[model samples]
Target: MERERESVSAMFGAVPEAAGMARDVLREALEKWEVRKGADDAALVLTELVTNAIRHGTTISVRVVRERDDALRLEVADGSRDLPRPRTASTEDEDGRGMLIVTALALDWGVRPFLGGKTVFALLKVG
Candidate 1:
């Protein structure tokens, strides 16, 4: 069981449990930042980002901060320069569905090279 850290905004290894850890970090930030809207979707957005990074990269960095009065920026960086592609997944397919989740929750999202790799980010609305 992982406890929530008030300041878990740092790099984490590419491990399976890191996804859950990232959620804890987002939850902590939501409370600390006093975000009142779209808080639930923000958590889901962070989870999908971190999970995708852990699947394809080595070291992972997760950060959550208020990007503006109406949005929060959640970022997950990983040691992989390969960018994500858009693909369609059938209902029974277990793969290629992460992006769908991200799209559903994030107000805006994209990727870029950072920290010797790539960082995937999402902006979730707060109001």
Candidate 2:
């Protein structure tokens, strides 16, 4: 939370509550940044990203940056070497639809390799 005015970020433990916490932080950031568009989609994307991080990796950190006047980038970094893959889920499946939801909401999303792990980022236009 001590980051720049155009950005807000938080680190989270690998817990179930991490998704909710990240979503709250993301909503606050969107409001503070005066971003009206894609607020709900951004929160949904953030939740999926955080949940995936908690489920698949450790040392999770969520960051939101005001990329431009019409764009915001949501980033979730985790201690995982394996990148995310969108999988097909059936009607009776209990899980494994995170990336599908993310893909449906985000304008763009990708992964970046880091020293210890990787950072997954989703771009949302918040005009």
Candidate 3:
């Protein structure tokens, strides 16, 4: 038997507002797929990923996928080949905490090289 799956994707401009926009879209998509358990965590992760992409790339694309067991996967693709480095941030730092939050929340997360840039993905075991 095969597991059922649902996916939603979109592209957003490389602007400050993109993160909020991505969160809205992700929330809608997750709700449609009945993924409520990890929705808040997913939103936080999405905000971090989308914000990082906007800071480094010109165009960003977001993707969310849900499996039959309710595990959720979120990805943010940017138009830059620069790889993501997860690092610890100091309390005084104004930024550089995105990946830290992602690392703490995601079941697993990594990057994959794509055509123009790379895709950073986080998986959450919602089930």
Candidate 4:
């Protein structure tokens, strides 16, 4: 049987609750699609993306696209023109490892500049 494809987009304010709300939306989408085996990772990615947006940008938005070829793409956009760089972590630091994890796990990932901001995206293979 062929897999299904789905897409969703949301906008959020620069607040702490945004991340949790994004996670909830993603979880609900995954459940509705009957997607499994990467929901946790996806949720974590959502949190990282949303948190970064809230910290660095004036507004945040999330877009999730599930492809018929069993690929899922997660994108987070914010009103910041800066591009994301994956940094090497030190044991003493409590943060700065989210993108690294996403890079390690995602099939493909990149950043693109938009009208007033940039969108960071990660693609995963979901069956």
For each candidate, the alpha-carbon lDDT, in order, equals 0.78, 0.87, 0.88, 0.85
Clashing pairs in 1: none
Please give, for residues 1-127, the per-residue lDDT of candidate 3 as tens digits.
5357888889999999999999988889876776678789999999999999999858899998886565889999998998877887788989888998999999999999988899999998764
* Candidate 4 C-alpha lDDT tens digits along 69-117: 4788999999999887789889999988988888877888899998889
The positional error of residue 45 in candidate 2, measured at the CA in angstroms, is: 0.4
Task: Give candidate 4 regions above 4 Å deviation.
Answer: none
RMSD over all Cα atoms, model 2:
3.6
How many times do residue backbones clash in model 4?
A: 0
lDDT, model 1 = 0.78
Q: Give lDDT tens digits, candidate 1, residues 33-121.
A: 67668988887777778878888759888988676667678888888888876679988988887788888777778998865788888
Models 1 onward score TM values of: 0.86, 0.91, 0.92, 0.92
Task: Give residue 95's error in model 3 in angstroms.
Answer: 0.6
lDDT of 2 at 127: 71
In terms of lDDT, which candidate is strongest?
Answer: 3
Q: What is the overall TM-score of model 4 with all chains considered together?
A: 0.92
Better of 3 and 4 by lDDT: 3
Name the Cα RMSD for model 3.
1.7
